[model samples]
Target: MYVFGDSLVDNGNNNFLRSIAKSNYYPYGIDSNRGTATGKFSNGDTFVDYLGAWLGLPAPPPFADPTTTGPRILGGVNYASAAAGILDETGQHYGERYSLSQQVINFETTLSQLRTMMSGPNLSRYLSKAIAVVVLGSNDYINNYLLPGLYPTSFNYNPTQFANLLLNHYARQLVALYSVGLRKFVLAGLGPLGCIPNQRATGQGPPGRCVDYVNQILGPFNQGLLSLVDALNNGSHPGSIFVYGNSYAAMGDILNNPARYGFRVVDRGCCGFGQQITCLPWMPPCFDRTQYVFWDAFHPTQAVDAVLAHRAYAGPPSDCHPINVQQLALINFL
Candidate 1:
């Protein structure tokens, strides 16, 4: 599988860049198998890592990692970067990031490398079996639309218009991937960012309450994304399958019933000071990490990732529309 998107799935692509949104330090991977920070934004593996494990593949090396070449490419590559978004300028303030379009370009580069190792038909066959997991759009809101002082997106487009704009850009980018030979896709919709520690830090409402205003604006994008999935599944791209991973519902389930998921702290992050959101390098994280829903200001703990990965892999249509990742994997092409 080829992974794309922002910090939610970023394994370490930002480590090679000049981006400030990095996690290559202590406490970031305290719970990972390596027990060393690998630039994952959580206390351990992200949902992408769990999904890869279920798929029987090792964690794909970051695409930007110089060591990620040759046989390593066969396991797939993760092009996810911290603070990346659907638009080119979405996270420009962060210094460097591979936006959705840039990630696709990198995939094209990977395809070029694969061609040298196999016949055209064999290459096509190999790509046809690969899954493209795209989890983007969160940064577009967190780093772009919401930051009116830095970006003009909010002033230029209302919530509905901004969503349409993002959808249009997203559709074109997905079509570009389809043209490149990726036959299967898992498009994860945005989760409720309103409840994240960063948004909560803003104190938009009553104490411990989520910023409903932030989540309200996100509805149109998630809804349009579902429609986009339907259109892509029924569109002109033969053999191309698009599945929408309803991250909103999957995450909502955990937040609304934290105890059901074995979580205690559902309102704040395990690391970082109040209102600071992102962890300062080397800061000590929570001792009981498994009981926390969030690992940092914006990302979830490895525990939450496990739940999300499970839902997307085998949950009902309400979690992953049309088919789950397991079913999508079973789909064969003649």
Candidate 2:
């Protein structure tokens, strides 16, 4: 599969690049069995890695890796980067990071190189069978809209307007990719931004309170994305295009009932904290990260991610609500 988008899906694109939004070094992957970092934003593996493993394929390589010199093409590659979003200003606040557009351009370049390495028929076959997974838009909301002061006046745009502009451009890119024989796609929707530790730290109300205003925008954004996916699927596209919904409800369920899913803490992060409620140097690391849902102020622990992934592949409950990342992957089998 061709995995695209931001840090959520990035295995190590930023790690190989000279970008500030990187997770390629020490202390990041300390939780893993190897206890060695692998460029993922979290302490362990990502949903993409889990999904790929479930599909019986080797985890996709990052597009930025210069050493991916091999012959096998059954597995795909990831072109995602930390803090990359649909807009140029998405990660400008942090400096010198490649935006989503740049990542797409890099993906095209990688595809070209792959085509050169393989015969025409082989390349065509690979493209026809491969699935493209896109998971993005979080940074656009978190950094661009939430932290717009860093950008120049000329690039300023509100959250709703910026999201619309991004979706429009993304539709064009999807169309272009469809024309190139990529038919099957799994488009991941935005997750609940309100529940993230960073947002929780800023918002008011009871502990573990979610910022409803920020989450309100996500519904409309996701609706627009669903419409886009429906349009693509209904058109003369070669393969099926499916929308994978992730957001408010699924996250809320897990947060509200942590015990049902085998978690102890929902609001407080697993990483030990000191004076600062947020997980940072001021705080001490948690004794056991598996007990908590969140690993840091922004991401989830591997244990929670595993459960979420299973739910994603398992499909919705009787109520028809969306499942987690795991259930989404199972749709391929269905």
Candidate 3:
């Protein structure tokens, strides 16, 4: 599958790129079995890594790797980068960061190279069977709209206008990909940003309470995304499309009932003291990461990633239906 978007989906693109938004160094993946940093924002494996394993394909390679060649092209590659978003200016206010458009351009370049290595039939089969998984837009809100005084002041765009702009651009990009050979798609919407450790630390809510404003923006984003997917799959787009996953509700469920998911701590992160500043820093290390749902301030722990991936591929209970990634996977989109 072609995995695209930001750090949430990035396996190690930031490691290759010379940027501060990188995690390919010490203490990042020190807890991993390999003992070497793998470029994932989290401690060990990511949700996409588990997804690739479930699909019976080798974990997708990072697109930034210049040395990758041959049969590795069959499974797919990840073009995601840290701080990338649906628009060129999505995260620019933060600093130097790759935009989502640039990531897609990288994806186009990778596909061009892959075409030279595969036979005609192989190429057709690969596109026919492949799935494009896209997870993005969180950083745009966190870094661009909320952090920087862009939307609330400079542009005067509220959450709704900003979300519409993001979705519209994202739709155009997806449509462009459809014009190419990409048929199957799995578009993942943004997860609950308000409930994340970072936001919780900054906000005044109780440990378990989700911030209302963040949820307010996320609801419309997911709704618009779902509507767009439905419109695309209605015979206008080629092949088939699926939602792939619903990270928001699933994460909230795990947080609300940590015992059910074998987690001990949902409020405090496994790393740092769950404080606003230290959670995003590199100095203070988190203590027993496996026991907590969140590894750092923004990302999920390896254990939670594993469970979320399993549920995404194997289906969740009825109450979560269309919101479940597993059920979305079973839609027979291929």
Candidate 4:
């Protein structure tokens, strides 16, 4: 898989850059097989990691990693970066990050390297079978438009207009990926941003309740994205299959019925104080991590990641629209 988007899917790509949005530290990978952090922002693996294993492929290496050269390219490369967004200026506060456009440019570099090993039909066939997983846009709201003090987006455009701006740019970027030979895509929509610990702790809602205003703003973007999926598949790109992963509904199910998913803590994270800040380095996380929905103020725990991955992999239409990842994998449009 060729992964894109923000920290939700980022697995060490930000570590290589001079960015504060990094998680290559203690207590981060406390549940991994090695119990050593490899820059994934969770107690164990991200959903993308689980999805990779489900597909029988090794976790794609970070594109910026020094070892991501030669034969390693065959396993795919992860270009996801923490704090990244659809807009170029979205995460400037965090220093360096690969925006969607920059990630595609980096993919072009990867494609150039692949051409050295395979050309024409071989390269096209290889790319056609690969899945391009894009889970972006949250940062555009969390890091950019919402930060009215740092950005003028809120002053310029309303929520609906901002979402449209994001979708317009995103559509162009996806088409760019298609032009480069990617035939399969998993376009995950934005989730309930208001329900996260950071937003909940802002004192914008009733005690222990989600910030409904924040969640309401994301509806237009998610609905428009589902429409974009239909737009792309209906002959916009021949043989291309773009599936919409409904992250909003998938996460909402877990939040609404935490007990059903074996989660005890729904309003806070297992590590930090469940405030605005993230978990500190070497901080001791909860021993019963499986009982918590969030790992940090913003990211979900490995347990939650596992559930979301399972849903996207084979769940019904409520989780993955049109077709699940398993169905996408079975298709050979080439």
Task: Assess each prediction's global lDDT (C-alpha) against the native.
Answer: 0.92, 0.67, 0.73, 0.92
Clashing pairs in 1: none
lDDT-wise, the better of 1 and 2 is 1
lDDT of 3 by residue, 114-207 (tens): 7898787777666766778888888877767767556442266677788888889888888777766777677776777888777887665665
Tens digits of per-residue lDDT for model 4, 1-334? 9999789988899989999999999888899989998888898999999999889989999999998999998989999999999999998999999999999999999999999999789999999999999999999999998899999999999999998999999999999999989999999998899999999998999999999999999998999999999899899689899999999999999999999999999888888776676778878988899999999999999999899999999999989988999999999977
Per-residue lDDT of 99 in model 3: 75
| lDDT against true structure, model 4 | 0.92
Q: What is the lDDT of residue 263 in candidate 4?
A: 94
Q: lDDT tens digits, residues 1-334, model 1?
A: 9998899999999999999989999889998998999999988999999998899889999999999889999989999999999999999998999999899999998989898989999988888899999999999999999999999999999999999999999999999998988999999999999999899888785789889999999999999999989988885789889999999999999999999999999888989873446887788988899999999889999999999999999999999999999999988874
**Model 4 / residue 49 / CA error / Å:** 0.7
> How do all models score by TM-score?
0.99, 0.86, 0.89, 0.99
CA RMSD, predictions in order? 0.8, 3.7, 2.8, 0.8
Error (Å) of candidate 2 at residue 10 is 1.7
**Candidate 4: lDDT of 118?**
93
